[model samples]
Target: KLVDYWSDPDRMKQSYRNAVNKAKNKVTTHQGSKSFAQGRHEFVEMKAIQDESSAKTIPPMKDRGILDEVLKSINRYCTQEQFEDLKRQHALEIEEKRKAFESQQKVLKKFVNLFNRQQGTPSSQF
Candidate 1:
């Protein structure tokens, strides 16, 4: 039904005008990221209206800095409770790594000692 409305030339032209006006406002910093995000959500909700293999389909744009941006954003926006939880989890992970390193070192030391004992000194030298 929505597509049928846009299929009309008059409605499509008006919609294009509204979109162009919004684009101009956005370029001039008169618009906010909120509306852009909402539009993205609407597009996704529309199921993109494309074929599985359509070359014309626009694949979702991915940010190369997404992980870094996410980490920064978390630092900026995380609540105290969330921050404490993350801090605790990070400490736990460090402790686990430390324990594993110590265990590996002990095993290596045991192996070296066993090897040296097996290569024992002669009775005359002892």
Candidate 2:
């Protein structure tokens, strides 16, 4: 729907003008890392769409910086609640794996004990 709206020539021109005006009146102060990252991502996406629709190709946007910023934002956004949730999940997964391993070991031990008993050997060695 956004792409379709952007494809309209009259609307595209208006949008381009709006973008230029916005840039001219851009805010100086940072609006936190999350919003800043989101805004940059949206701006790059819009620029790419505009370039695709237009005849004249504009210089490619600096993608590496935006990507790095996004990664940093994600890392920074890991609040205590989210961190605790992740920690809980990790511990749960580890516990489940440990249980599975213990069960396998128990089964192997039982098999070895049964084999020893059949061969008339002591089961205590296993």
Q: List model 2 lDDT by residue over 34-64, tens digit each.
A: 5655777766876565555464465444455
Please give, for residues 12-84, the per-residue lDDT of candidate 1 as tens digits. Answer: 8998999887878643433355576664564464443333224445653333232232324544576565679
- After superposition, the stretches of candidate 2 with alpha carbons farther than 4 Å from their true spots are 1-77
TM-score of candidate 2 relative to the true fold: 0.41
**TM-score against truth, every candidate:** 0.36, 0.41
Clashes of each: 0, 0
Residue 71, model 1: lDDT of: 27
lDDT (C-alpha) at residue 15 in model 2: 88
Give residue 22's error in model 1 in angstroms: 28
Q: Using lDDT as the measure, which candidate wins?
A: 2
lDDT of 1: 0.63
Instruction: List the global CA lDDT of all models.
Output: 0.63, 0.72
